[model samples]
Target: MKNLVVAAAVATALSMASMGAHAASPNELAQIREQLEALMQRVDKLEKENTELKTENENLKAADEKLQANDDYLKSEARGLRKEAAQQAVEVGKVKGADWAGKVAITGDMRYRYEMISDETLSSSGVQTADRYRDRIRARLNATVKATDDITVGIGFATAEGNDPRSSNQSLTSVFSRKSLDLDLAYFDWKFATWGNLIGGKMKQPFLKPGQSLFWDNDINPEGLAVNFQGGMFFGTAYNYWLTETSGPETNLTADTMLHGLQIGTRLPIGQNSLMLAAHYYDLSAGQGRAPFYNGSNGNTTDTVVLNGTSTAVLRYDYEVVNLSAEFNTMFGQTPFQVWADVAQNQDADDLDTAWSAGVLLGKASNYRTWELGAFYQVIEKDALFAQLIDSDFANGVSDSEGWVVRAGYAPVRNWLINATYFLNKRNIDAPTSAGQLDIDYDRLQVDFNVKF
Candidate 1:
């Protein structure tokens, strides 16, 4: 463009020179030439300024594109960072919830009872015992923690009158005296396999007691190591319990007493119904000729032994007991029904070594507004079982008794129930009394209000 402008100017100048060569003087021509030079110089300066402006414009476009690219990148990174932070917050909340709330559990029950007992026991002096009535309360609290996926730890506390392993009832006597509270359960359970558990410490009974059977009292928590297993329809338990720890030598079987037990059972399906049968065998080593009595003998046959110049009644025979139990479960028109039987024998005792019980139950007292009814007849001979470990409420916790127990329960609300139990029993059925042969009538009634959480 600059060259074209200069050429056009030169052509115009030549045309003027050619047109005015005869009519123009030297000064005019010289002035025209000088003016043409000045215009060319001005055109060159303007062209240089236009080139600089184009270069500046290209640089500005490049800088704008670079800034826009940077803005887009920053926006995308910020969005990703915000999403990652939200996910981290959610993960933190889940961990907090599991640690504080999901892994720990607290559970317990409280029961208040009104009990009445009528005894017709006759003493050697021909005196009859009096009837008694009492109000009792039991409160228990337990806490469990899932320390790991396969490990659990539990601890519990309960109210009791004394250190009686069979009962945890605190009588409402002593004019509002401060009652005793003891450690009821403290144990750790480790799931060593998919089908078994290993538990140690003073723990709940690992053996199954079918159909509310009194062969093993519900409140008895044995101390030692227990192994429990279940595979398909088969289940079993083995336990090594410390009964007494004497400082005497191990070879002296008359001092230290230990109880070892094993139970094996199976559940078989039979046409929409199920039947469970189990056999449990336990032996009290070194119990014979030894006084391993807690709260006295409870009517087990005993022989007097002199210890430290004091005569004490020791167990007459070793207790090697085998228990067989069976239960048939069916549904009776939407109500659960069960028929069960339990029998036990002491192989070491030659006389009065058998006990048996049979029962039928209809319905279950579970959930709100549910009810149940059950009855069982049992006869425990003089040496049938270890009396200290049997049911404390049956015939006043004595052997040599035959009785019928009728139980009814109703749940008025969730986790709360009222129960009524009646015992019609005769004691001293086979054992000889202080007098002659005798069968004394004994009766008991208990009404309980229980709640759990």
Candidate 2:
């Protein structure tokens, strides 16, 4: 049988291969539903991009908490503006008070002096010889306080009385008390802008030139320490008091001591004119034992001799004194002129004599008149008054003495002053009873009325 005819042609070739796989199974189920609709449109676009990245991470965490609350409100407004600038710096240091408690200062001067003295020579202790009219009064008051800024403290009061031209002319109607308003000048001043001033208690002592009265006696006032300086060349130094002691010897042997002095100065200027130089030193002793002319009497004491039984007599006195001066002041137009010269030396007992003077002054004050013209010449050598009258025999061996003065002044109003003066004196004594020599001369005329404030 040919194997049943090839099994019927293999069952008709498996029925046409199952009809071509059922026609490709409806196009593979329509291409698997178009690939599941393109995978659900890409999972709905990845879930809308995960909800837009969670709303941009909650908007960057709310802008980082609003920038940390604006940095804590700018650090609490800068700590309340630094606590109101530290309470306005403590109320401006409590209204600025005490830096030395309100300082106060006052100064004063009042003067009324009139003097007239002429040819005096009459004194057997019953002294009287004059043609005079005198009245003097001076006043001063000053005060200050400023405990800082280079420190300062001051106080002063002064008063003066006059008429002591060797006492006579009714004793000048009594007012004898020159400078007793106490404390002429109490001081403490120090300023140094390159070493210029320094002062300590009881002032006024700078060799000479404070209106020059020819060395000493401008109503004598002196105490301690003083120094002054200026660069264009001017300097000073002082420590004063040549002698001071009231009453002793017999009222129980009382004693006091003080006699130490020194002063130095310098000043220089040429073209316009200015020149001054000075030096002075003194150290005197023997502070006690008053009256009886220091008991060493030698007027022959009516003859008394006792050798070893003790009846002694040995007289010689003088401690020390030295002075030197030079001056020249100038101004030609407004009128201010001065020329002065001086020399004084008394080395005491050892006898080294010198006393000299030369002067010239011309002045002017405007708005009417305040004139002046002066001339002077003086020489007292012969052992400088023989050691200043060594225990007096009415002052021995006094050889030469000369003087000259002429003055004129007028002020009209402001403090009132008027004056006129003329004086000339000469002496050459040596007649204890005429061995032949005693020429005395004098001529004087004066009138003055002054009031100053």
Candidate 3:
């Protein structure tokens, strides 16, 4: 570079010297030398500035590459944070779902009934017995909660005596004393699959009884575990009910009364009609004489049969029951009708071990002003079923009873119903008392006003 600049300056000075060789003096030559020197100085200054600019550009490129790498890293971190946030949201939703109280549903019903009862003994026996009249009320409240998609829990409160499982009606007696309100039901139903459910605690009866309430009452909620299954039109249930839980007198005595039950039923459609049929077998374990059937309730007590008139000798008793129920539902024009029957037998009782009931119902009530009429003839023999577990209003909650129940119901509005029922019944069917061939005609009249949510 220095050699090239020196050559250019020498060539320019020679040209100028040749042109002014005969006319120019020493001062002109000196001026040319000074011009050449100034040009060389300017070129050297530009070289230093260009080198500095190139160095600055290289530094800026390195900084730009570092910035690009940082940008990629920041973008990856942002994506990870967004994914983590979504996961946390799902976890929060699951946590909120387990808060059962906020998600529970509440429902209840109230029933007011006026009842009149008369027994033939009250009429005869040279005794003037005024008809018994009573007013009763039943109030029930229930709440259900969802624990998950497949699990649910329910709680219920009802008005009833703590000991009697068959009655929820609080009689209007005791000079306006506070009626007993008890825990009616508390259960968890776990549905692990589409076809089955496992339920625990005190719950609604898991067995299927048809339109006729023969063996089991409507108010009996069994405690312990129950399992149910369904496939197509077929359904079945198995239950292990805890009848008694007690600390017995001895260590080896398992005096607890248990009821093991199995039931199977089917519902099928045939042309324009539907048929429902079910059978149940309940094996009463340890219920022989260990358990009290609603203490002081004679209709459900077991008599101690002394062997050879010896009071010390007693017979072992077991009430094993098997029952079948069937119903036929068909439409007469737009009106619905049903014919149903139920039969039960106790394999252990000495006599009158079989009982049966048949009923006919016309015009099912579903809407406002819709009316229905039904009549049933039921004969519940002694020891056929635990009388305490039978319908409380039928035969006055006594076995060895045969009765005809006629009922009429009307709906004034949705979820509100008015009904009248007449029970023309007979008691002492098997003559448990000393009165042989003696039967008392006991009749009951009931009028109910009910509302439900």
Among these predicted structures, which one has the highest lDDT?
Answer: 1
Please give the RMSD of candidate 1 to the true structure.
7.0
lDDT, residue 45, candidate 1: 93
Runs in model 2 with CA error above 4 Å? 1-96, 102-346, 349-453
| Residue lDDT tens for model 1, 1-453 | 888988999899889989988888889889988988999999999999999999999999999999999999999999999999999999999999978788889999999999999999877887888899999999999999999999999999999876899999999999899999999999999999999999999999998888978887888999999999999999999999988877744454446788999999999999989999999999998888877777888989999878657998989999999999999999998999999999999999999999999999999998889999999999999999999898989898899999999999999998999999999999899876786646789999999999999
Error of 1 at 186 (Å): 0.6
Residue 201 lDDT (model 2): 76
- Count: clashes, candidate 3: 0
- CA RMSD, predictions in order: 7.0, 23.4, 7.7
Clashes of each: 0, 0, 0
Which pairs of residues clash in candidate 1, taking residues 3 or more apart in a chain or in different chains? none
- Locate the minimum summed-lDDT window of 10 residues in model 3: 307-316
TM-score of each: 0.80, 0.24, 0.75
Model 1 lDDT at residue 18? 91
